[model samples]
Target: MDTTAAVPPATVIPHPSTAQGATPVRHNLVSLRRLFWLRWALLGGQAALLVSCEAVAGVILPYSPLLAIFSLQALFNLLTGLRLRQHTGRGARPGDAELMGQLMVDLTALSAILFFTGGATNPFVSFYLPGLAIAAAILPWRHVVALAFYALACYSLMLIEYVPLNLHNPDNAINYHLAGMWLNFVASATMIAVFVSRLSGVLRQRDAELNLAREQLLRDARVEALNDQAAAVAHEIGTPLATLAVIAGELRADAADPRLGATRVSAYLPDLQTMEQQLELCKSILARLRDDHETAAPQRIDAWLDGYVERWQLRHPHARLEANAIGDAAGLPVEAARVGQILTILLDNAARSQLAAGHEQIPLRLAISLDDHGTPPTLTFRVTDRGLGIPPAQRARLGEAPMASMHGGQGIGVYLAQSAAQQMGGRLAWHDHHEGGTVAELRLPAPAPEPLPAAPPPASPLTTNPR
Candidate 1:
């Protein structure tokens, strides 16, 4: 009765703009992780190359300052790891500015090493490009441009600075440069491939999640609008329904009076009684609308289904329905009213379909079952009608929005039913029955079964006189 209850509150899903605003922070967090490991790999490679140059290439170079730069880079890397751990522990992530600062540090560290080894003449100076590439992949355009300019400044400064590789054989210098280029190519290629591809994957996944949230929010908005309309209509019709009930009561009373005469009284008595029953039913519906906010106690699945089917029969006395309950599982608690509304809509549709297909004589079948073997257990309701099965084109579009159906339905009820199903963490689907009709199935998440009471211990054996 309370349609708004099916739509999730705004607090559950933030606005689209808010989601967009948070994207940068998430992107920065992912970038920082990759940067952390990238720096570690660079440090290890620099150390290995330094050792090889000294032992194998026979190059005499300044080891003191270079080793000091490596030690400082390693220490900074340890601090970066600690920062990441601390932020993550508190359920926070590093921001874009922090990430930019990290890239700047790497650039500075590289320049310091290059300044000592051979400045711009060092073959590994091209490593600056890979760092810039990584920055571009994760950071915004403004941050990427800033990092680019900073790297350019470092390169220019290196060109004018000091420190040259001292080699005994000048002929081997070109060979070393060529070999270093090959190694740089391999390392740079690997770093870019691993980090950029993974970052792209993360970006793709985030986009997918955002899109899904946006669609869900849109659906909820539509449902909320529909609920407002329903509430208004309910309020407006209350007086008219009450008036009709009073009129029906007065008519019945007059029919019972002897002044009406026996023949006339008999003619109208049955119709008057039917009118009274229908008026009571309408009044009950309005009463439910008033108390929609109250949380009704859950009812056992079996009892609720039986009562619902009986009430449905009252609404459609002309259409015959065969209701069957199958399953041994007992005491499966169900949200009675909410589920009843969903099934009521389904049954109404089936009846309409039967009329449209000229099969009103065919008895509609309703089967209810409790399946405990499912992972979380499921309560299922199957409604089968020998009527016009859904068209292929309309199958996918059903319940998405209110559209005019071939069977003369406005489709608002189906949409509400679908939303209600989702709110209950359940599913509603329709398929062609094997017996040549449409079968609508509603699968609801059944509550966990109550534990069985422990058997009482047998009364202690009657006290023996020998004791």
Candidate 2:
């Protein structure tokens, strides 16, 4: 089923900084590399246009100085490429200042070319705008403003003094100027759209990655806090649990004595046994805090779920759980305890919902199926309940944070379950069941075929087996 709900904000992490302006803007090496190639294209175009105007269109210009400026631009481009190639360290990147410097060099070169051809009257004088637009996109506003003023000053200086293009016929000046203006517009528009759009896309991708990192940090912090709280709670309950265990043992000893009536002793024995079992369960859970979770051996999904359901049934005697494991998946390398914990949370929520809706008679069902259609086949544990469906507004925000539920629940379990799912490289999502009520589904990536260890050599018939 498709999950359309947006991920909720990270609310557990405290004191998140929201001041975006405090961070400095720096362009990545990709931008600089692209700008390098783009400069080559512009240089080629300038050369082609210059040759066409002088030879084909019969417009006189100073070839020597123009070629010298062109050579200088090419040399600078070569140096930029060398700089990029030489710098291969982790911090090797074009910063805002370096990029602005490159743009400034291009503008100065353009101004020099224009001074020889037609000064401010040159049609390509407006080319400054495209570069300025790119600067605004990648650099900070201060750099953009400074570049703008510099270009304006250059243009003003050009207007006061320059060589004009000498045409074969003075009457053709208006026609040539109009044609050049059209070409300038086309070139300027292309440059602005191509370069600025590319830079914008990179900026957007960077922002998305930043948000992902921030959310991950928040999740880690919340998980750490929860773990600390759990440890402290476990420590606090240890003494009380030990005291109850001693009291239960004394009651059992008293029940065994003939002084107590046989009928009363028999009746109290079952309750005492149940109390002892629960106490043992609590002690075992507390002991698990020190167990190395990473060393847990892989087991069959069906086998794991069967044992988990039996243990869960002990804790929840009233609510019925019907678990079904489908598919022939072998050796699922998952953290069974964590998965069981998440399922416990889901099952508890389902039972609460059922009780709230007065449908305690209906059994909550969990179907574990292996989806082999996709790469790295997925194991889905879908828990369905015959209870009231979650409200549309609340459904979207269900696992985002702890919220009050109409079913007398704090909703902390669901939030913790979702976080645990994420930690295990899985996801938990809920949708309305087709018939009624809600279905909470957990999908985990299942990599299969953990090979069995090779069998040891058999002992001789006369010798004893070492196994």
Candidate 3:
């Protein structure tokens, strides 16, 4: 069957347009608030540092004019904090470009203050490099370049003004100091530029990969939903097709006057049988599909498996069935229907494979057990058959791969069986049996159930009133 044609196309809403109107107000508010808090914390830290520096300088170096500069930086931090709060309160977020521009403006003002305090000769001038690094991290390439140029211009102006002045030194030490400062600034700027650019590129690549994975996941979900719908439709038509087959057979036998020739009736009989078989196949497919989503209240694993084996034996009367509990599986609790379906699929597959191979007598063996290594236990089911072992090439594609070419003339029974096993948080894997033929094993997590309370004793019956 062409599953795509049987199922309708799924309507997908893109992530950006999932919310109609209202501008995604909640998300925008959250994003803005998060940014506001981050910026406020950073600015608050900067303010504290400036205030501490100002206090220390005022006490130790009372005559030094740099104390005023530190105070001015502290005031600027306080103002930036207030602006951030206001922006957050209004539910407004500054665009990336605007934020970068503001960072550049703040860095430039700091650089100017540092130059005025001690020019290139002051150790505090080294602090300017950190601001430049921050700018590189947050700003676009063109903006970073523009900021770098502005810093260079300001440094040059400070050097020109300080070199001629003999405020601290008699000799012209400012020239040598200016050259060293310029080299440090250039080196820091280069390093920051390289680091930030590489980091941004890595983030962009990771985002692209995540987006591709999400899209692929959505597409797979749509395809699976389509398959489920097709299975349902096939199941619904099965009974009617079976009825038609019965009627066709009766007509073939009763037509004795030769209104329809024997050859024509014979040709129609095979087609009728084929249709009936197709209907049965459809019913099986639908059952497997339903089993994929089945969940049942927890029950003892051994009892479930034993009961299932008994039911399957009735269905395949000619097959010899052998079932055994290997370990503590009898007491293990599990979702009975899902576990039963998985066992049924495995046993049915083994039986059918044996019949297809023309085995004189079909032998189906099943083993149920548990593996308890640590806190959680694992339930295991192993089904072995004395049939033609799956060919090496075909065994490789038994799980999720399409089995059209592997099955040759047969339909998709094996594929659906494998799918049902996996949907139950288990796996179906085929291997050669010890003596011969094939064995498929399924493993699932043991269900954990809370202990039930003991029941109360029943009371004696009361006398009934006269009618």
Candidate 4:
């Protein structure tokens, strides 16, 4: 009897460098769990203190009401921990919507509890500010505004309704008591607002810096990949170029009499000339590849895509190429060389596959756009090919294995493209195009930089020869 039950299929886990949006969600969830535990511990300590106060002072301190409130808060904390554990354990990230919802609920509950337990009169009400601070630091501005409103409303209500019952005694001055309570409320709220606003600003700055560092990392990765490819390309072309050079040398050296067999000599002359020209082309290609290693400049999207598509068409003259731009190309930020390299690989693959299938023409399309809904916009570059679409099984493994042995058994180009995307703080995703082919989408965050003085116009053609 076979003892082996079929194993479940493995899930695709994106690398931290390549995973977008999800990384922050995972980070937020983990942070929330940590905060939850910290709050739980604090609440436990608060409970112990309440017990001590009730025992020694004989003052019916508000332990019962506070404990009951804390119980609900603890439940929410436990649920949050469970959700975070599930997310991290599965190697999957949480969604933004879910994260936002959790934050809102957590803040609302804490604020409500503070309002009910003596509002401004409660000594511990100030503790509630930290929760709001966390929300403002991580959430978008709109959500931050919502939290601000929640804080204002809760504090306002607490100031109006809370009144100490034993104010007529010789020791108690109701007016002074009310005045002190209002003063404390104003002070705590002011401190919380100032601290949270400042803290949120600092967080935003740090997040921007993190994004820039990630982009630089991507640029380094692309440079490394280009170096490797340049080496391989040189190796591949060297032998052919050497053979042609040798043949040209021999023909020139022979110098057989043109009078005895002019026709034969003339024919050989054309062949030699053709070989020399092809050898020159090879040498030029090698020179350009070498030069690329020296100056790895950033690229403009519109110009880069246009040039790449044109060069691809030159190699496969019969292939169809299409391009579309969705964002303003004038001021976009991207590494030109890396973007071009990625487009070239995709277009080259499509052309080769089409040629192999004996098609006279293959269609290729590229789209570039930006997503502006969030604080930092995201840039999207998509390349689609109307050729043999990748199978689901193979698509699943596109970026998993060493490019050399992925599902379709192709390597280098695809691996480099994927690597370049990640190095640039972006992701490379492959899906079936709606019109019956494969689409590769690269997504990156667009963080605006400090404005610099304009430089001289670029000398190189906006688009290079599509080789």
Candidate 3 residue spans exceeding 4 A from truth = 1-26, 29-295, 310-317, 373-377, 405-413, 416-424, 449-467
My TM-score estimates for the predictions, one after another, are 0.52, 0.51, 0.42, 0.46
Error of 1 at 244 (Å): 1.4
lDDT of 3 at 335: 65
lDDT of 4 by residue, 118-207 (tens): 567655556556656666566777876777787777777777875332222425345444554664476556545654565556557556
Residue pairs in collision within model 1: none
lDDT of 2 by residue, 255-313 (tens): 67787636555667766666665676676556655553521455555446555676556
Which lDDT tens digits does candidate 1 get at residues 1-467? 11121221112445865756566556666778788888888888888877888788777778888889889999998999998888767767787789989999998988888888788988889989888988888788999999999999989988898588888788999998888788879988998889888999999988887887788787886567446535533632443455456657877777687886355556767666666656665656556545644324566654555556666665665677876556543346666666676777777788778877889888888777778887887888888998888886776777777666776566776776787787788878989878777988989887776543322322222111110
The residue-by-residue lDDT of candidate 3 on 1-467, one tens digit each, is 11111111222434522322223333333333333343444445444544553343321222234455555655655665676676667866555565555555556655655555456655445655655665565556787787788777777677656422223333545553565466557645654555455545654655565566567667866666656556534633443455566667866665654755555556567656655555554555456445534433566654455455554554454577777666456555766554565565566667666776677275677777778884567777888887777777777776565455322424254455456666666677889977777888888776664353322321121111111
Q: Which ten residues in a row have the lowest lDDT in candidate 4?
A: 1-10
- lDDT score of residue 28 within candidate 4: 60
Residue pairs in collision within model 4: 218-423, 218-424, 298-336, 299-335, 299-336, 311-466
* Alpha-carbon deviation at 252 in model 4, angstroms: 11
RMSD to native for every prediction?
16.2, 15.7, 16.2, 13.4
Best by TM-score: 1
- The whole-model lDDT of each prediction reads 0.72, 0.72, 0.55, 0.58
Compared to the true structure, candidate 4 yields what TM-score?
0.46
